[model samples]
Target: MRRPSALRRLSLHRVMTHADYVSTHVVGRSLLVSIAAIAVIHAFGIVTMGVSSTSALASMLLAAGMLYAILAGLAVASMGDDLGQGYASLYLAHPLSRAEYFAAWMTAGPLVVLVAYLLSVAAPLIALNPSSMLDASVYLPVLCIAGQISFHTSVAVFSSILFKDKSKAILALLTVIIIAPTLVVFVGGLLASAIHTVDIMSLVAKIVGVFHPAVFYMPFTPRGGSASLSLAYGFGASLILYYLGYRFFKYRTDI
Candidate 1:
């Protein structure tokens, strides 16, 4: 009986994992296109401008402006199948814990994002500029940019679990990335001016900055003065959000 039960548990894990992997097919194709596009950009730059068109600033801006939308979609695609498509009932009908299901989604979604960055972004950059791989000046910023993208991806995943709808999840992510911070700063500024306390706005801005973790590494050329602090905040916030999302998924009755 014990052996049979253990085997059943193992089988469920594989099933969940495979489902999550299959859901990433769209994201995988997008990443493949990105890789090809980046390579072409490099080739064009070499022929026309004497160097690769891609730079740390361009990469950071891309991550902040456009690439994040793709990554966020990837994040949502992994879990939306179960939550949005009513497959959660089928999966949960088994003796599987919700924790295991959540873990499988998290694992597969972010792994694809990381691999995408390596192949689509980093590899092409390095292919054209081999020496930069060894130069800390070059590689460190790239790694930091990747970190920023990963942080956003995690936030996107959290939003998907929170909203439980693919379209809303992506919308919420864009709001956090593009709108919330600006609004917070504006409101914070007004409150500070009214109270004659600049710290009020500063305090509010720092708190809101957690949602847009990529800002910490902006202007990736000079590098931020608070690189270590940015890493700490981004990593800490991601862990907190992940824990909250997992707990919500595990205990929520509606799902």
Candidate 2:
């Protein structure tokens, strides 16, 4: 029995190796450090440029989302290349199950990126010393940005494996990148519109606001409840995508 247990442990070791491959290859450690440097520069740019805080925050929000989405796309592209270029042949020849490999790959990308992003943001907050922007009300939804990134990353992983080509994988990622947010905003708007009868400007704000998360620590925004709903959708959708990815990977045949 102990001998069988030892064999099982040896077989399970591939999962960690798969995770290591993702951490080093999918998103390099140096790249994460460079992002931190960029964050520091962004803070300096904000201080010297006399940019309005609201506009600055909004720009950061959108930019972060776009940047993460692109990185996630690249990650999928890299993994798809691995599959397409026959790396998967050597990889799958081991005692490891495809499900184990997929689980490791799927989990590693989001976690490593999330850790990097958090480290990148921390330096900026410290160096900037802009106490004004620290208001929870203004930047509250920023907390959920990691979840949003993971959601995009999960979609990329699934689509990439299913398509089995880096180019097609990226295309699939882009399709979801465009369609998912639109759907989220539309659904959030429908919910928001049911509660408030507002004009074009207000309604438009409400619709856009649906993509932000609410801070339980602060008083409500004009559309705070919807913002909370948006946060839930963002995270909830990530969970769903991750499950779909895992299942697909478990059943997927090697290329």
Candidate 3:
């Protein structure tokens, strides 16, 4: 089946290309398999590991941390070492337009990671305590991951486009994904709290609020801080980056 809405215009062939891209890559697939493996190991752990609040929380963090792998996979796997060689001639020569390529690559890129991440993180927590899903503390982390993944995917894709070299793109994606979140949530949030200046983190939080309809559950939000929205911001930021990346790849990438 074809993707819906705006993406419906993308041909079936393009969608298949995305599937092909995902199937052909080792990094994204391996990351997904590793996450699934963790869940599998936990599911079978009758004697070794026991589920508890701490273990559940650890799984949640592990799932959230999948954002790092998502970024890495999307940044490097989409090109399949094509971008690292310093040219897009092989892809550009294809029947696909640059826009089509980018859309498909992005449309299907992080989705794989998202599914694996959710299952990996949530499966363990649920197995440990089925009622945990009812707890905002448990669900909030999973919810936030959606937004976080989107944000990181866009960042990685943008980096991939910004730098033709694979390694450099991955580096840029990591810098922003790792450093930006800390600075925005921790540093910026802390500074805002100290001086009561502009709600630096709040502004970002407001954008991603959809990710966590209720914002106070996570540890990132200071006790008295402003809004800590995350999902909407992640989706919104991704949209902007996707546009920029596509535009650049479409016209300026001839270089």
Candidate 4:
């Protein structure tokens, strides 16, 4: 017999079923709510700040915080009700392969995050302060924020896949939330305290800040400043997480 075409192997029926399920699922609804929340929060910040020079900075930071919240919410929402287990089961039961299933999930999740971030942040910031648009500083923070979101989302997805239990996934997320800041502070604090100087803490703070989406969009640090370097570091960290996530998903069949 002639070899089945790629399309034939990935049956249209299976693809359609997956798409339908995703559309009807809470994931879609959660995405909508996240986007709306980001937009509303940023708009309020802009209005409250009164379109002043400082307001632009404040709005940018607010937008970044909203994006971080959305990303965290997405991870938590996916973990609730054993959604990841259900997704894995549905994909494995069908003609679809794990690779295809993962591809679809990764593609959809990041696109949602990116669109929501841009719509919530870039649109309003530019509208209120067009000059800020031309500043390299503005773009740098956005890049850092994007990197942070990607890295966190990847980690969350990997945790969901590996843990198999929704509660465990939630725990994983909470662990990250609780640990990251404290670790940063402790390390930075220790370095500064030991040296009897604030410079060491400032350096450590700048380094750790890159990994956080909320810190990236703050206007105090311009695009060409240390924040830019931190954003670059965030992108590099994100790549490593993506690779690890891919490896874990590729080899593990227990899901």
Candidate 4 achieves a global lDDT of: 0.58
Query: Residue by residue across 86-108, what tens digits does model 3's lDDT show?
Result: 44566557676666666556545
- The pairs that clash in candidate 2 are none
lDDT by residue (tens digit), candidate 1, 73-129 = 455544654577676777678765676666666555665555555554455446677
Residue pairs clashing in model 4 are 137-223
- What C-alpha lDDT values do all the predictions have? 0.58, 0.58, 0.56, 0.58
Residue lDDT tens for model 4, 1-255:
999744356545555555446534735766667666766776566545635654365456545553564465364336333444465665577676755555555545655666666666667667777777677656555666666666666566667666655566556655555466568878878778888745875565455564464354354344324565556656676677666766776675465
Candidate 4 weakest lDDT stretch, 10 residues: 216-225
The sequence of per-residue lDDT tens digits that candidate 2 reaches over residues 1-255 is: 345433254444677888777657654666545555554554554455413565455456546655655665566556677777888777778776776667566546655555655554544555565474476534444555655666677667777777777888777777666655477557666877676655443444444433332222112333344445556766777787777766666665556
How far off is residue 75 in model 3, in Å?
4.9
* TM-score of each model, in listed order: 0.67, 0.66, 0.65, 0.73
User: What's the ranking of the predictions by TM-score, best on top?
Assistant: 4, 1, 2, 3
lDDT score, residue 35, model 4?
A: 62
Off by over 4 Å in 1: 1-21, 24-66, 74-81, 182-209, 220-224
Show where candidate 2 strays beyond 4 Å. 1-13, 23-52, 126-135, 178-225
User: Global lDDT for candidate 2?
Assistant: 0.58
Q: After superposition, how far is residue 249 of candidate 3 from its true place, in Å?
A: 2.2
Best-performing candidate as measured by TM-score:
4
lDDT of 3 at 233: 60
